[model samples]
Target: MANIKSAKKRILVNRTKAERNKAIKSGVKTAVKKVNAAIEANDKAAAASALVAATTTIDKAASKGVYHKNTASRKVSRLAQAVNKMA
Candidate 1:
């Protein structure tokens, strides 16, 4: 409902970006969940592998500006710690 042409374009662009960000965040959440499930199952090997994939997904998300770098780092660190502690 933006009357100005530029404002309408901005609204469209923002909506598209919001959808993309939502998808990226959802993927990150799923990746993290996979890692957590592996850890809870006490499968060391699975957890280790899942952590690597999750870390990669998280890093990509951060690079895409979906997440802040330090926030992503903290997430990876916590997941890695849980996996390592299983040993």
Candidate 2:
């Protein structure tokens, strides 16, 4: 649909970026789920470990621009709180 060469290149670049962002987003969700699962199972040790992993993943995602900084901080904070409550 892009007749201009620059427009076509931009479209291609955007598609690649979208795919990468999608993968990062999926990873973020998986990490969060791991933490939640650990919490629900009442495994304090596992939850703490998962929380650490989730926080790292979220921080990376935010740094990569897949998630907003505030959103990532909020998620990490809530996950940490949940893990703490299990203690």
Per-prediction TM-score to the true structure, in the order listed: 0.98, 0.96
lDDT of 2 by residue, 38-75 (tens): 99999999998898899999999999999999999999
lDDT of 1 by residue, 1-87 (tens): 789999999999999999999999999999999999999999999999999999999999999999999999999999999999995
lDDT of each: 0.96, 0.95
Clashes of 1: 0
Which pairs in model 1 have colliding backbones?
A: none
Worst 10 residues of 2 by lDDT: 78-87
Worst 10 residues of 1 by lDDT: 78-87
Best by lDDT: 1
Off by over 4 Å in 1: none
Clashing pairs in 2: none
